[model samples]
Target: MLIRKALIEDLNNIMNIIANAINDMESKGIYQWDNTYPNEKIFSNDIFKNNLYLYVDKNIIHGIIVLNEHQEDEYESLKWKYISGNHLIVHRLCVDPKYQGKGVAKDLMKFAEKYAKENNYESIRLDAFSQNERACKLYENFGYNKVGIVTFRKGDFYCFEKRLIKYGS
Candidate 1:
């Protein structure tokens, strides 16, 4: 599989992946996403900003991840460990339901980490739905530290941060 920046032509495939993910999540009792959030407009903006990426195999998109500096206003109140440097925030990470449990999300995360480090980012931040055990575990297992909680329309989410650069050496 190859991870690359998303192009305008990949929007439909990206949306299909997201729609499948949303349906699967809802079926499994995870209401973290819905029709209102993660709409096409938001993804269009992500693509336009050059922050969207796709995990593809043989030209078929399997997963997507959005990395940028934008964070919710609620993050301002959270006590983050890496407070004084450029940070990459992860958003809208999703995989097609057919590709779930196949390390697609993990691969996307690996890509995000590499991209952040290569781009001189000091840390990476994200918020996982409190009820999404799979996502929470993925972040925790990947060594992300739980910093705080942020409440959105769906519910409270656990804010996590992973520092990529140490102070010395």
Candidate 2:
């Protein structure tokens, strides 16, 4: 498997994987994402703005992720705070449902941690929908500690952060 920066040409394929993943989630009673999350305009903007990354295996995109360099102002003003300094905020971490249960999310997270460490970021942060118990557990088991909560369009999400040391120490 290969993890690399996403290119404009990879947009449609990535979006399809996203759509299918959402549908699978919905079927499982997980309300994380749906059609509205990846409207045409949003995917177009993400491609044009260069905010996405993809995981490829044998030339197929099996996972997708969006990263933000800073926390939004609303999160910034919240009562809870991060460990310190700049953080790479992760969003829309979706693995193709076809490739589910194969550690894809863990691979993406390791990639994010390396990305942050190399860029001098102090930590990696993300929010899991409160109702998505599986995601919440995954975050905790992956070394992220819950620091607070924030409400998003779907619902309130538990915020988590994993501090990164220079060499994974």
Candidate 3:
């Protein structure tokens, strides 16, 4: 699979991937997303700002990730282990439900880490739905520190941050 910055034409494909993810989560009793969140407009905005990225293989988008520097107000109150104004905040990380167990999520995360370090960013920050055990486990196993919890429209989410270092350190 190849990971690269998303193009305008990739919007619809990305939305389909997200929809599949939402359905997969709800089917598993994880209410992490609903109709209102991660809508087309939000994704359009992300695409406009060139913050969106996609994992594509042979012309199909298998995963999506958004990286921005803005953190929510709720994050300001959390005690993060690493404090940095220079960081890449990850949002709306989703893999096509059909391709999930094939290490697509892992590839996306590794891409995020490399993106941060290559761009001279200090770290990667993100939040996961408290009920998304698979996502929480992925983040934890990947060495992201869960520093606090924050509430969003769906429900509570655990905030995480991973400080960047030289590759292979």
Name the candidate that leads on lDDT: 1
RMSD, every candidate, angstroms: 1.5, 1.9, 1.5
Q: What's the true lDDT of residue 36 in model 2?
A: 79
lDDT for each residue of candidate 3 in 33-131, tens digit (9 for 90 to 100): 877898999999999999999988988888888998989999998988777549899998899998889998899999889888888887889999999
Residues 41-78 of candidate 1 have per-residue lDDT tens digits of 99999999999999999889999999999999999999
lDDT (10s digit) by residue, model 2, range 1-169: 9887788788778878878977888888988887777666776776676778888999989898888775755576454455568888998888899998899988988888888888888878888889888788888998998888888788888888888787655
TM-scores of all predicted structures:
0.96, 0.90, 0.95
lDDT of 1: 0.92
Candidate 2, after superposition: displacement of residue 132 in Å?
Answer: 1.4
**Which residue ranges in model 3 land beyond 4 Å of their true spot?**
167-169
Instruction: Evaluate all candidate structures by whole-model CA lDDT and list the values in order.
Output: 0.92, 0.81, 0.89
Give the per-residue Cα lDDT of candidate 1 at 132.
98
